[model samples]
Target: MARTATHSPARVDGPPAGPIEIDVRTRVFTWITDRVGVIAISRMSAEDLARARSRRLSHNVVTSRVFGPMPEDVSLTDLRIAGPDGPLTLRLYRPHGPLPAGRHPDEGLPVVVNFHGGGGSLGNLDQSDWLCAHVAARVGALVVSVDYRLAPEHPYPAARDDGYAALCWAVRHAEALGGRADRVAVMGDSAGGNLAAVVCLLAREAGPVIDAQVLLYPVVDLTFDAPSTTAFERGPMLTRADMDVFRTNYLGEGGDASDPFCSPLRAPDHRDLPPALVITAMVDPLHDDGVAYAERLRDAGVPTRHSDHARAVHGFICFPGVCRAAGEALAEICEELAARLA
Candidate 1:
């Protein structure tokens, strides 16, 4: 008989002020993230994220200040590996807290390779630290948050190439990273989700398919015709206008929006792709893209789960402490992956 052990539940403390109670935490983080909406590209170039860091310090304390409010205990490190084009940078976040040396439950664990959401810009592992910690602890997996090259400088296939390269690196070096290559999964939110989708597609086409993929509020389609696009066209975390700019810079001129690599929703076929866990935030503009992709997968005879987090917005998967929806979504993804891969 396979014996199963139970662990204590993870608890969140001191939420922010808001009428809406999101996931496990408060509205505090959202308030901060909203204020720091994408800074002008000019400002980012003029000054190297100094201004962004200042804002993060003011209200984004929990995420900005490392070692402060980190879930219980965790180990974090920055790693650089070679990608298809060039060097690939990533942040390896793992939960090794409290438990003594050899007592660590997941000493040798599987890895969830993640990509941060920012419409191909404006995000890093630091911004998604909370969710990374939660996944590492709850799923007992080493979470490698890939910091792929962003848009404008590196467009379309560049991001995809980098993401796939990172995937290859993770698999090849999983043993050294204390993870199992055979059990690797790819995950992302929003634009990052888009990358994850393409990564899976390309991986299947090229062989070495990943174990699974988890996409949250993903922008699977470059065309903006989804109902959620109009539903959340105005004031929200992610706006349609913002998406336009991201796509322009990400695809550049001469880019093919219909290319399955750029838009997995337009893939010729999804059959034989690894099982997927697709999540869409109700109020997100990209919600329909996720839905349409899931439906396509079903049509193509691929196992997929489509879920919508009602009353949520784009890229909520990483705002763990403040967005209960995000936490729940992450838990669902991890649970499903564990069952499938175990």
Candidate 2:
């Protein structure tokens, strides 16, 4: 039987206070992209934003390869389900292999509902294929990657509501989907990580208990005042300016940045949420966001494990081919989920 890592509560406050020596490959990758005029959304003109949105519909084939090959044992299927606003497209990944002895095909597998990173404005289900498929195959769980409504068009509560709805939908139809309703978890990176954290908070008050939450360099605080935000304002992959654009697109006018749903770190009480694994990148602006949230979750008596990648940059998890730490982070996520969902 395929088994993931254990769910032991390990506390890592954050990265050590100092200049982070970024991985050589990560440095090279960012250097090339930066020179190629990779525009941050905050600096984008109307036409630039339009072109960027158009390109987000599909993953760049070359980039997908750079994200590392998909697991051959995983089969993907895109299905449309009812969302809070309308129909939501979800990409499902299931592993193909012989069942463990004495366990029925439909009952043993766990479920992971994933949200892709793109600061809530960019990204699609295809961008999540690499991570989702690997988790499904290695952790032996059925992964459902949500193509939630984006920002600047479908702002706050739209993506948040869609996330919760998808979780409820997954639980309601778990058996048919070859997963265990009782063994469900939420996972995401960056903006999707924010959604995942918010969904756990909502679920705590609502229903469909979430077994675990894996936050990859999550933007838990939207106020953008975290120490790392200032420390790495001009990031290797993400920058403070990029965060401003994401925040504006996500919140729109009059949106409350202090709201717990918008900023999970600001949540008054993180006392009863699910077990959490918060992964942080030392060189990223959002490093402190994940760090502080993990601390809050731990202090609130929630089982929390924090792991910081010293040599990583923002969004490192998305490029395992280049970021050596990405694979390590992936293993940590799978292990934590396996232990919790088991």
lDDT of each: 0.70, 0.83
RMSD of every candidate to native, in Å, equals 7.9, 3.7
Residue pairs in steric clash, candidate 1? 16-26, 22-324, 23-323, 23-324, 24-324
Clash totals for all candidate models: 5, 1
RMSD (Cα, Å) of candidate 2? 3.7
The alpha-carbon deviation from the true structure for residue 278 of candidate 1, after best TM-score superposition, in angstroms, is: 0.7
Q: In candidate 1, what are the lDDT values of residues 162-258, reduced to their tens digit?
A: 8888888888888898888888788888888888888898788785658888887788878777666776675356777777877887898798788
Count residue pairs with overlapping backbones in model 2. Answer: 1
Best-fitting candidate, scored by TM-score:
2
lDDT of residue 263 for candidate 2:
94
What is the alpha-carbon lDDT for the whole of candidate 1?
A: 0.70
